[model samples]
Target: MNLKDKAKLLPQSPGIYIMRDSLNNIIYVGKSKNLRKRVYSYFIKSNNVTSKVEKLMKNIKDFQYICTDTELEALLLECTFIKYIKPQYNRLMKNYERYVYIQIDIEDQYPIIKLSSEIIEDNSLYYGPFINYNRIFKFLEGLNEILPLIKCNNYLKEKITCINYAMGKCEGPCIKNVSSKEYKKHINKVINFFHGEKDLIKELEKFMKEYSETLEFEKAKIFKDYIDVFNSVFKEYKHILRLNNYNKFIIIDYIKNSIFKVIFINNHNIEYVDTINMNNMDKKDLEEYFKNIYFKFYLINNKESKNIVTKEFIDYVHIIFSY
Candidate 1:
């Protein structure tokens, strides 16, 4: 059958598609709802494909697809296939290195601490691909203020002698002052914060209330300070909700040595921000990986991207600390 015949057979439902070259090399992997419509749209002579697409089309000889239940399911399938095929025409998620993320080993007694330019299937949590190293560090410092979890293996020595320990700042893991249970609690808090918990402010409020009842003013102050930091990160929410609101999500990206990316949900959606430092990962490297990872980043969010006009985060940090 001709391309048109194959196209006519594509389902109107969501699914992942693959474009292969004469050599049977997969050049592109994508997902679409209404596969017939999306594939046909690509074949339009005037569609103005990207330079990469044009080259891909020149070598294209055949294609295949797997239908899915929903657009989101197609998205998941697209990501999976792109990783497996590492196609030339697809932009892979974490395929690029403009932003580097911090990876932690979830399986070890103490996981190895390191930086990553690639996404792993391991159960470990990936923190960022920050374009600004300084901002990433600043954010990590803020995180440390809320959670007393040790970030790295500064406890290799039998004696707890890290700088933070020496300075009487950290309750050393080496010293066992921080019990496993307490450490686990801090881990959960950090994870919840990063994963966009809508109840974050509420959780803090509850913790503060309990701390006050126990007369643990110092501990309560920590919660208050975090709330202050949280507020600084977001401009005053017109309406703070006890839950996530996902009408539309917008991006406010601050680019420097890392990308300090913020996800702002409008029309009552929750606002979540995350930063990753790709300072160590060069653009040339990420460019090579873009086909695999970059495409996972939905550019629809870019439609809403604009220069950051507010220094509210910086201003809030200053005002809250002045007290």
Candidate 2:
């Protein structure tokens, strides 16, 4: 069948569409809330196609699509496929190294927080590979006030008072002033802040108000910037924490004929994700299968699990499951 014929067959639902060239190579991948409309739009003769899309269309001989349960699922699936497939037309996400993560090495005698572009496989905690460096820096600075962790990298001498300590910024772990237990408590606070336990926004608001009252306009502005950044970043963290009441939970999404089960297990610093395929199964059978699989996995792993489901994932599940 022709491309137009195949486009007509696409379901009017959310999905990830794969466009392949004559040689059966995937050239482009895209997600849409309405697969039929999105795919059919490309076939419209009157539609203006950009140079890139024009080229993409010229090579396109066949296409396939995976019907997702919701638009968010389609988006996530599109990203996953693009990362793995490395389609020629997709350029933005090809270089994943550009992403940055905030790393906190709590294992160190004097733990220091810093930014890392690479994902390090270590015991240290990493927050994100976020695009907003300015916001991350401001947020980290605000966190420093609450946690008072060491900011320096070099090892501290026994008697020398570092500049940070002199400024009352650090807890002076190098001088052994703060006991390891006490330092650990500070680290826990920082970890908790990241996990949405402590309210950085409230702290920023308090600081901002204090500075404003004292007529420290510059300082108040800085605090205001931090507040803005925290508001944006914390929204996602808040969503994750909402499901923290559940030690372990399963989110099942029935997409077209396939059932996608996302099993989330939350441990100390890592969130483990396992996907189960329960295609063409009844709800009762699916639940039984999930229990069997979850028990065996839990017994083998023996780790604490929590419901850290992403807002997008949960929101999409609600949309698809509602139908």
Candidate 3:
């Protein structure tokens, strides 16, 4: 069938579309709340399509789409497909490998915190894939003042001492001054601080005030920069922490004749994701199925759970509540 005919048959629901070229190569991938409307918009000559889209349309031969239950699901699926397929016309979020993560080996006798660009399947706690490495490192450095952890690579060694110990910036794990248990307590505190259990902003404010009182303008300026960086990165960290409070929940929605389930667990971890086709079920049945599952998993009466749900899925819920 021609592109126009195929587009006409598209379901007016949230989904992702894959556009192919004459040789059947996947060239473009996109998502839309209304697949039929979005796909047809491309074929409209009067539509103000960008130069990139115009060029893409010229090579398009055929297309495919995976229906999703919600626009959020469609958005997430589009990102996954784009990353895996590496479509020619998709330009954003392709270089996910370049993103950085802060890795801490909690299993180690004396855990060391460091930056990582990849999340290996080690039992370590990984903090971020933050694009701003300098800001993150600076924030860590500032955090060290409030909650001191080891800053040296050669920790837990016998008869070795570092300058950090002399400066009182780190507990002396090198000289057997800090026991593994004692050091682990500090490490746990650092973890808690990262999880938003403690307010580092207050510490920053105190340090800034001291610097200014001592007439150390240089140090004051440095703290000011740290404050800015921390505030910027903390927003994302705060969101993840909120999601972590909910032990488990399933986000269910219907696209066409299929049900999509995205199960989030262990705080912000994605436990399971799948789509089930139920061609026999109608829209009313789908809504009933979703409500049954949602109420079973979601504790609406619990005030804390509601707050966590509100903060965690604020973006998705805002769109839903507004409608």
Off by over 4 Å in 3: 1-13, 34-69, 89-91, 99-101, 107-109, 116-123, 126-135, 145-147, 156-168, 177-182, 212-218, 231-234, 241-244, 250-323
> In terms of lDDT, which candidate is strongest?
3
Model 3 lDDT tens row, 16-71:
99999989999989999999999988887866778998899899999999987778
lDDT against true structure, model 2: 0.69
Note each model's CA RMSD in angstroms: 20.2, 6.8, 7.8
Give me the overall lDDT of model 1. Answer: 0.56
Higher-TM-score candidate of 2 and 3:
2
State the lDDT at 210 in candidate 3. Answer: 97
TM-score of each: 0.40, 0.63, 0.61
Backbone clashes, each candidate: 27, 2, 1
- Summarize candidate 1's per-residue lDDT along 41-131 as a digit string, tens digits: 7677866678877787777799998886545446645655665567877764424334455566655444433556666767776654434
CA lDDT scores, all candidates in order: 0.56, 0.69, 0.71
lDDT of 2 by residue, 173-200 (tens): 7778898788888777667777766465
Worst 10 residues of 2 by lDDT: 310-319
Model 1: runs farther than 4 Å from truth? 1-16, 45-48, 64-86, 92-142, 156-160, 166-169, 173-323
Candidate 2 lands at a TM-score of 0.63
Single out the weakest 10-residue window by summed lDDT for candidate 1. Answer: 308-317
